[model samples]
Target: MRFFKYILTLTLFLALTKGYGQDLDKVDRMLSNYPANPSSTEELANRIKNDFSNDLERVRAIYKWIALHVAYDTKALGKPQRVRFSYRTLAELEAKKKQFRKDLALQTLKKRKALCEGYSTLFQNLCQQMNIECEIVPGIARRLISEIDRQNLPSNHAWNAVKINGKWLLVDVTWAAGWVDYSKMKFHQEFSSAYFASDPNEFAMKHLPDDQKWLLTDNINSKAEFASQPIPYKYFLGKNIKLLSPQKGTINMLKSTGVQFNLQNVPADTEIAYHFKREKYGQKVKSFTKADTLSFKIYSELKGKDELVIYFNGEPALGYKVIVK
Candidate 1:
């Protein structure tokens, strides 16, 4: 009887651990083979409604479809066009806003491209049609390492907050769609599910919504604290790495003996390295891994206001500003 109980527990554990991935894979496969190229948001919403019964699955379908099909508009980013609509009454204003959102989504669908606003508005519109509660969250997103520790950043980005099973989950379809290669000035259509239903703590690392209520977590004390966090790349979150030390975005070398990083859940074979902006080649930082935890230290000649980057498996994973007092 005890043996049978132990086996049952192990089976449940395995199922709990692997079920989400299996479900996501099934959804991806189903969507990939879907025949219709939806010409309008209504048609797309209807297809999603018919195909997915659960709220989570329906939202996932909308997110996956938009992330895969839509391209980021690079030209619009440089020269944004604005239109003004005149309305006399509050009801008229509300109606116009609703119509405006629908128009934006349809425009994005027709063009197959959009800015962050377009991505978010389309997601919100589709969620509304599907009877899922969602909101367009406007905020400041720290994209570049140079933006670290900078004061009073302009609200430059927007994402979505979706309510599934009475819980608000965050989604960034704009980022999931792809990244803009600034060097070549091109948008790459690489679909990543990392931003879908991300942890509030992890999402707060780079995104601070204009409204404090949208943060969804009390771990981040204030906007200043959010601004003062190390820039985490998609790889960091994708791999589920935990940054355990130097929590502040800027490190003071003069006050501390040396810079040491304590990370958790790092793969044993992963190579870690770091370099300043002035260095051509990165100096490898030897890490000691024990039970999925890794620790490494950087002892180097450093000076004032240097940009320090940590590389994981030859990819830039984290960025911090180093200050020598």
Candidate 2:
């Protein structure tokens, strides 16, 4: 019976993730065929230039190569700065800053390892060399499910924005490269093409840009909305879950303070569970009359950052951050 249930679950998952699997497979093939360090940045750029005339094609090739070749630098995540310069003149400072960027680019190319900034900077440099307009956009990124409720944290990540044929698109080479394993404190190499030219609404779920212009879409998400929305991972897309309230993975506690979601094909026996302030709110939360719609209200005395999690059969499915102040 257990084996039969397992098969049923697998079939359901496969049905939901069919399109996602195809896209993921295509990205895997591209990365697998990517060449190793091609002597220098210019050599690789010229190679891509000669092979692809279209701007989008060139960007795809470059993004895939870097995603496969470069590994994330885990040690420098929160470490203090290693470079401190005392310049006697403005010219010296300016020159030092320029050289610092050059050195960083060389290190990322030669060693094939870098933190998020290094990844963004390297992509920008390569793009500039190819006459593609790219800018490094620094901002805060939600890296973990636990961070869904945290507040007042400084910006700790960087991504890129490129103007392709006069239209701006967002990119994150570092995320495309891989994810960091907190237990081992090392990077696990993986390629995700979703970060390349992602839909602005989807991208804003986990990434909050410091500058508003970089939102890169007509429908801009406010900071409050960003904070309230669930961390948008590829899983949500793969599983085909449609979120309702706290639209765009964000909620306005200052206003309505209601949360809602709709999941398809949920089992009749299964119940919707919730967690708040690190404790499970058992019977206090009510069950859904209909299997598809899940709704709940936030009621917490805690005044700062707090988290609300939705669970099914003891496994967490979606999370939201709420600020009481």
The top-ranked prediction according to lDDT is 1
Q: Residue by residue across 218-309, what tens digits does model 2's lDDT show?
A: 34446665565577555343343445555534343542444445545445665566666545453245646465665555455545666666
Q: Cα deviation in Å at residue 156, candidate 1? A: 0.7
Model 1 C-alpha lDDT per residue in residues 1-325, reported as the tens digit of each score: 5335434533443343244443766677778965446778888899889987677788888889999988999988878568677999999989998889889999998888999999999999999998999999999998788888786999899999999767788899999999999998799999988788776777888999999798877677777788899998887864656777888888887634668899987877788889888657679987887676689988546566788888888888899988765
Which residue pairs of candidate 1 clash?
none
State the C-alpha lDDT per candidate.
Answer: 0.82, 0.68
User: Model 2 Cα displacement at 10 (Å)?
Assistant: 31
Task: At residue 202, give the lDDT of candidate 1.
Answer: 77
